[model samples]
Target: MPRFGSWLLAVCFFVSGGAFAGTTCPNFFIAGSAPTLDASLLSRTTEVCHTEYVLFASGVTKGPLYSAEHLTAAQIAGANSISRSGSWHQETGIPTADRSQSSDYTNSGYDRGHMTPAGDASTLTSEGETFSMANVVPQLHKLNAGEWEKIENYVRNIATQQGEVYVVTGPAFDPTTIPTIGKDNVAVPAYTWKAVYEPGVGAAAFLCTNADNYTCAVVSVDDVKTMSGVDPFPALSATMKSNPIGLTLP
Candidate 1:
């Protein structure tokens, strides 16, 4: 249990597009991590269990435009003894009550894939917080467990190796008319990408398209923009920008 009001949050997550600042989006980006997009179409913020997960709403879909988080190695290690054990719960961050619900994923075929993984929930509170719907996207089962999971595990490994890393991840919804899950019409992204920067070590990004035998695409930060129309990492220093980790397998 946090010391009453002593649970100080170190990161700030918000939604921006046009003049509306209330759009929900995740704050996975830390202080001065990236530059804000000049033109945002829609943004929304959702709050649940006294915690806020900022998510950007898409003009194309009612669900989150994306879910994000900012985490450190120590912050992730807070609950070292706990195991991965928790159920998916509802999130009220979206404007519509029905939009961000647990049932929205019921039989939707897509897994409620976590952009912010559950491995970080090492404490009672943080563990439960990891279940927030605002932190998830409708992802395929194979992709979620396979390539995406590999990427997440690799980042965790980096956290253990170098100490800390900044991560921002979510879906890249294709502009063409696409399939949506549940009644809320949450658009299914053709691909999903995660942009990571390990301060002293190195940084790189990759994307996993949803499919059976999915092969991921290792690309640059600018390449991510061509897919998702957003700059997750803005104003990067020379090292991280120039030194991207290659997607080499073991």
Candidate 2:
């Protein structure tokens, strides 16, 4: 848990409309290892829309994710960008569903996706922060609102069972440059990537999407050494070692 002072500072900043000072998003250090995140840049006062469980940044949005006070943006740039939301003590900004809208706009064709998935925001406060608009992106409505959301929930449940889980998520764009929707309002992506680490078993999993589709690369804690590509494994510390299992794709 983080110190109470940090929580207080976050709340004050959130309420007072302060902004995050750094261009880089925060990193998650677990088991003596620090991993990077990928997401869009953060923006202030942008219009956020929820079409089920997935939250996306639409009109005139800047940055990757936003909280009440701060904006979360990426650090490294390429096919992917990393962003962080949430902390140790306070569970302030986990994005919620817009129940007022009909499930018609949320379910069926759409994937119950998460702008900031559960494993990524492993901590209570971190998970809460993920709920903010700055942290969300356009996800497959069905996946975002359904099975995908379930996967995130399951990860959280497993984390609680094991102890804690550290997660990192970001999109893998095709051109590397951020893509914009055309007049037709079609959302296109280059690619997407997600990684998860469970300290309880020293297990890890990485998933990648090239054309809005999900594929799982189940590697043992040791096998991670062999994986490489456009988005290589962010680098793990000596203290982190263990293979992950039970991962499913949508």
Candidate 3:
């Protein structure tokens, strides 16, 4: 595991404010790397999304930490849906490329599917803001709107029960990546994970994938203890943290 100092350093870089051209998340850390965009062009943007996951620059459609594939700023800006506006669309537009090449896999398919659903953020606008594309990924519709959605709701319940919680979610990047979209435009994912932290309450994370029949294995984060019958996502040496500002739930 990474020492606390190293973890702190990584977190500092993310919330440093200036590192991302006046954009910052309370406590930021790299979830994973995908395709990248032009830093120069992104640096010009002042738009910032307040989310536990990705953060963005003013003019940049995505955050510096994310990698964009075939998506463009114009497409992202124009593709907004009434279903996702106001506080609900804050950190929504995290740039991601449609490497899937599915004809139906336009930027809209990659709509900022809430890892932490809008219901969780009913208390604050920042929670709604976190729903923008800057915080989304090219998720399969079934997973995004199905089992994964249930898990998000569960986490929200946990947060409400616990008073406050820290949740970090993102894609798992690897060489043998899952086929994002089939030739027919069907979307897919090899696996996905959501890590939840509640400081003194209790910490746990869950890993699920299409390959696993979408059954989630919830593991305790308080200790390194593993859960039986549950598969673990690739473990990171460092513990990921996010800024907790603007996250107060009603």
Candidate 4:
């Protein structure tokens, strides 16, 4: 595994014709392209870029559609030393109506789960930014701290082993049901997923149910696209998207 210097490019992002702000922070994506959401689910979406990750927030869903990061071995090593920030707040960069406030999650019976785990932040500021409500979803308690946490740890470990990896994580919601929480009605997702891509190796995704059962499995990237309505690796080959590489689950 090769290592690269740990750095940060802090910027705000937005979708322009399905791409991210005309090449700003291109390294955060694979092949310099961002994911595309299915037409049906592409309304009032906001993209927010932080020091360590990029969040695609959904106005309708009141949570992140997904978060993207390019993790390197040096980055993970630096991140390991950062202290966790328990502070969670609203993303002011997003429109008032499109963002979730910390109060929305108060006693909502769901955890304010991070799409971009704070454990991956390499600095104190970045760690604090990870706590933004824009990068979170209403995740089930069991899944958030159980299998979900395991998956997060696994990805960081792989980043260390592979030198670097592209990670995209988000939630999947049932449009018809649309479970919600709090005064703001933050949407509760049916499932949460993480997709990991090693440059030369292949790609695979982890899907964990956001319910009492809290079951999780490794699935093809295409399966994740179909379920989440987002094509995370648009530049990835069809064969790679169709086939899932074997990954150890927790």
Find the candidate with the highest TM-score and give its number: 4
Model 4 reaches what TM-score against the true structure? 0.90
- Residue 89 error, candidate 3, Å: 7.7
The better-scoring model by lDDT among 1 and 2 is 1
lDDT of 1 by residue, 129-196 (tens): 76776667788899888878888777777766667667767676654446887766676777787877
RMSD of each: 10.1, 15.2, 12.4, 8.5
TM-score of each model, paired residue for residue: 0.76, 0.44, 0.47, 0.90
Residue 24 in candidate 1, Cα distance off native in Å: 12
Relative to the true structure, how large is the alpha-carbon lDDT of every model?
0.59, 0.35, 0.37, 0.82
- Order of all candidates by TM-score, from best down to worst? 4, 1, 3, 2
- 1-250, model 3: which lDDT tens digit per residue? 2323332232221111112223244333323222122233334343343433343322222222231111122322232222444432323242234111223345544433444344443324444554454444456567677767777666555555665545555343222333443243323333455656554543455545543234555533311111111111122232422121122211
Displacement of residue 35 (Cα, Å) in model 3 is 19
Report the candidate with higher lDDT, 3 versus 4: 4
Could you say which candidate leads in lDDT? 4
| C-alpha-based local distance difference test score of model 1 | 0.59
Model 1, position 14, has a per-residue lDDT of 22
Higher-TM-score candidate of 3 and 4: 4
